[model samples]
Target: MNWKNTTRQTLGTTVLCLAALAATAASAATQQMVSVKGSTLNMRSGPGTHTEVLWELKRGYPLKVLARKGRWLQVIDFEKDRGWVARSLTGSTPHHVVKSRVANMRSGPGTQHRIVGKVEYGEVLRTREKRADWVRVERDSGKIGWIAKRLLWGW
Candidate 1:
């Protein structure tokens, strides 16, 4: 209840808050997204073709690039599946994967809009534009709509 103690507590709280914000910003700035460029891109345990294949990612599959080797890149997907892929098989196209079991693709950026299509879990959609918490997405079939950002995990 003394002035000194109150000021010290306030300063400690301020420092902790600033530290948290800095960490968040740093991580956000470092994160980069890339998409699978081929029909089937093999994700390996190591950064080369000789390594064990961990997953077969389809074209447009969004991956968070974590690190890079000579000709390969370490990546993680929406499901937290981590592996290495060839840099040539990836591109800078932005995309998102449905993290939820299912998400409604709406005509607009809110629930008020009519549902145009349904997106399934692990399904990748090309990112078009962002409006508030909703993102405009394009299905591979050529259908375009808006989906709530909370239901997706990607760029």
Candidate 2:
């Protein structure tokens, strides 16, 4: 029998399987939002509700999915905090959260534009557009304005 040939073929198959798994994991690195049901999403230390709650994420908060278990997603925020959230409570909508102490919302994409409003830390805003380093954002009240991308996090 061709023992060496069989071993070589098995090794090649193993490499291909690993590559496919790597690609799947890369694609799983998607941004998702906590579904807005007039409540907060509990990020837990483990995949189950029996685990300790690490944090409570509000609606519109953006999270990067790092891994997934049965019905739960291992997620990380703009602050680099990691936790597990129920997959059913997340959505595909694009959003951003204010990471700085305060973010100035302007009428235009640059600082020369008029200041339209202000958003504080932990506040979440829907992503509207991007111009240079400025990101146009919309508040829950339907107001639209631009903020410097450096002052916020998420897509």
Candidate 3:
């Protein structure tokens, strides 16, 4: 084969390989999930042989996967906390369901406070702040008040 043809073929192959590697890296960085069952799940710094306790997760916890290193997965919780958990303990679960139904948005934490407006199911509320169990949500009409976070899911 001519040197020119050989060089051209080698360069093309190198480009293809580089492209494939880049694609793989990009997909790995994308966020994913590993299911957690039972009452609590432990978070560690490394995959196997826990060295530190990052946090504990309750049942029906959906974690955001940061990356996978061997048999362990780096995950983040709802509050944006990061840690590592074993891949064996994580899997897919379809039983979890979050209800969109919301009753009323009050000015304060309890129902005794003045009612600003009522929020129905499937309506998305923008959370502005949180005060203990109560979260301040922005309504569709631009009204804001405290709502119980426990009343809904996927906040």
Candidate 4:
């Protein structure tokens, strides 16, 4: 091959490799919350309905999406449990689960804010807003307050 053709071929190969790398980085950076929209969403050992059911998740339950495969999503919960669920059963609405024992719910998004309530370990709360390192959450029990981001698990 001529020198010019060789250079062009090398450049095309480099561009293709770079594109693949970028796609992988984008997938790895994706961390989003998905809530169970159905009354009962089945978590499976594999990414299909034919797979063995690992468990059943109730409506409003939130999961952190790790990856996706066709119509299935590989997810992880606050307990660090990993499973696959049908994408149709989940929504993009954000939610959070208390990871720390007795996480203080504050009137504002900081330590200076008065403690409005306390969330026990494994408490699931709907995400209302986010400010800096704090997240505003509303419990299903009608309690609303802000908690430190690190004390909870979600997107």
Give TM per candidate: 0.81, 0.78, 0.48, 0.81
- 40-146: candidate 3 lDDT, tens digit per residue: 77898777664687777665566667888998888875556788888777665411212345567899888789988777754545556766777777754788887
Give the clashing residue pairs of candidate 3, or none: none
Clashes of each: 0, 0, 0, 0
- For model 1, where is the 10-residue window of minimal lDDT? 25-34
C-alpha lDDT values of all predictions: 0.92, 0.87, 0.69, 0.89
Candidate 1 local lDDT, 38-152, one digit each (tens): 8989999999889999988999999998887899888898888999999999999899999999999999999999999999998989999998899999998999999999999
Cα misplacement distance, residue 18 of candidate 4 (Å): 3.9
Candidate with best lDDT: 1
lDDT per residue (tens digit) for residues 22-90 in model 2: 987677565444433335799999999999999988888888887889999888888899999998888
Q: Which one wins by lDDT: 1 or 2?
A: 1
Candidate 2 colliding pairs: none
- Give residue 26's lDDT in candidate 1 (0 to 100): 67
Model 4: residues with Cα > 4 Å off, grouped in runs: 1-17, 24-30
